[model samples]
Target: DASRIAIRHGLPNSAALPIAQHKDYDRMFADIRDKLHAKSGDPVKPEHLE
Candidate 1:
């Protein structure tokens, strides 16, 4: 998860961390909307992201 990445690499909360790089948070966050969108069928607002 992005939260875990923030703790693992020690990145600040504001950091988005490159999505095309790592295989964890980077990968998850990259397709968060697409994945969640399939199940929820919404706009996937920022606050709604996990």
Candidate 2:
């Protein structure tokens, strides 16, 4: 199932997640936020989100 899902998504089989352990969602979100900030020159502060 994992391999099939990966192939359907055009990703390597290794990209599939294991059943035992999951990924760090918070860290992933933070990394995405940082990348977006770097590319957009947008402020990430609470006051700036308004």
For model 2, what is the error of residue 40's alpha carbon versus the real structure, in angstroms, after optimal superposition?
Answer: 14
By lDDT, the best candidate is 1
Tens digit of per-residue lDDT, candidate 2, span 1-50:
87788679987565354522446765675676785564344456665455
lDDT of 1 by residue, 1-50 (tens): 88779678876554464553567875665587566664445556675654
Kindly report which residue stretches of model 2 are placed more than 4 angstroms away from their true locations once superposed. Answer: 1-23, 38-50
TM-score of 1: 0.24
User: Quick one: how many clashes does candidate 1 have?
Assistant: 0
Top-TM-score structure, candidate number: 2
lDDT of 1 at 49: 51
